[model samples]
Target: MTYTVNCSILLTELPLLERPAAAKTAGFDAVEFWWPFETSVPTDVEVARFENAIADAGVQLTGLNFNAGDMPGGDRGLLSWPAHSTEFQDNIDVVAGIGERLGCKAFNALYGNRIDGESAERQDALGAENLAKAAAGVARIGGTVLLESVSGAPNYPLLKARDALDVIARVRTESGAENIRFLADFYHLAVNGEDIAAVIEKHAQDFGHIQIADSPGRGAPGTGQLPLGEWIARSRALGYEGYIGLEYKEPAETAFSWAIRA
Candidate 1:
């Protein structure tokens, strides 16, 4: 299983571009960011600086979580948010252009908390329609829009894997867009009682990328219940050759050297 690190956890002390060196030092081959646009919004000079940083560190840009306009404290949602539907495609166009410039090929669309008055069916329909629109634009840039399911609870909605699967299948079928897929995060699966490997196998075609954090604490893979090596083996057996993103918080250590085989 090839490994990539999300720079959000490590190098929290510096700019996004500077995180690559620390990521490389910690033995990662690729790096991902939640929202690079926030740090340097709409400026090619800053974008160029980030591109140079990746080039210098020799790390590939795995993917980016699309800017949901929350990094600046404006809102914690994306185009999937009903309020932003009209401007959603234009927003995607801007981000897709940035993705094209940076060589990243994947993006995430996470639906936040539920609307107070909407029924489950209405929300799902809106989500499918908006995501399908975004996916069409994403495909033009040779990137994919992955609909991520966070555990639904007091704090979030659309937390169920079955719900996300339904939306993805319906949208793909309706839009006839093929590049859209699912981003399975083990942390959410652990919270929602879904078997990680079972879900992957069940939705083989929709599975595109993965992120992992051990259950109970959302720590490094081996730090909790997840069997890292076995998962690696199973993923390969299942014909998954994409990046397995390491997105967990380290308590005190700079690298997960114990969990990773040298």
Candidate 2:
């Protein structure tokens, strides 16, 4: 029943380096983020500053995303894209180094959107290879690479739980790396029109990490109609012991009011 804040999404008001401390001030002992840097390979000074910020804040980094291409510009991730395979491969060590220093273990690899002319078969093959590389890269720290089902990006593939799970199976089979697992973000699954209760009933214990935001507007728990608390309780009841990441959008001042009320 532990909770972690996703600093990338929740603390948008603060500067990137400052969000870890902000999360600590808001009473979170653990936090997660998408790639904090703009480039796949940031400078040594940049890496040191990022690591130091989290350490200074006294919060544990529980999860992080691989260098997904320009998120605001609509680039979802680099893993499945044929052109950016080099950048994706280059980012593995940088991600693992940060994870090693910060004690973070879960690494989320966003499956990129389909290219205009590239066949789905090519993209799928490249994705599986890149995911295998990422899996091996983080295996040093006993890390697990996470595959997530996403929403809102029309061309982005892997919109359902089974889609991600199928890829996980492919990676394991082709690469023989057993460290890959599912990132069950309830909001996205619900938004994609999946059967949430049925998904949980079948694969609750299979998730490596969990993220939450209410659907329809992606707001905090009470701002939407989603039964977030109940869903989390069901996951825990079924043996999900990982952090419930608060990856919601809300004003920082009142972001946690629903949690406080609960």
- Return the top candidate by TM-score: 2
Candidate 1 worst ten-residue window by lDDT: 71-80
Q: Which RMSD does model 1 reach against the true structure?
A: 2.8
Candidate achieving the largest lDDT: 2
> Can you write out model 1's per-residue Cα lDDT over 56-91, one digit (the tens) per residue?
998888887766665434343455556666655556
**Runs of candidate 1 exceeding 4 Å displacement:** 39-41, 71-76, 117-122, 152-155, 259-262
Residue-level error in angstroms, candidate 2, position 30: 0.5
Number of clashes in model 2?
0
lDDT of 2: 0.94
Give the clashing residue pairs of candidate 2, or none: none
TM-scores for the candidates: 0.86, 0.99
Give stretches of model 2 more than 4 Å off.
none
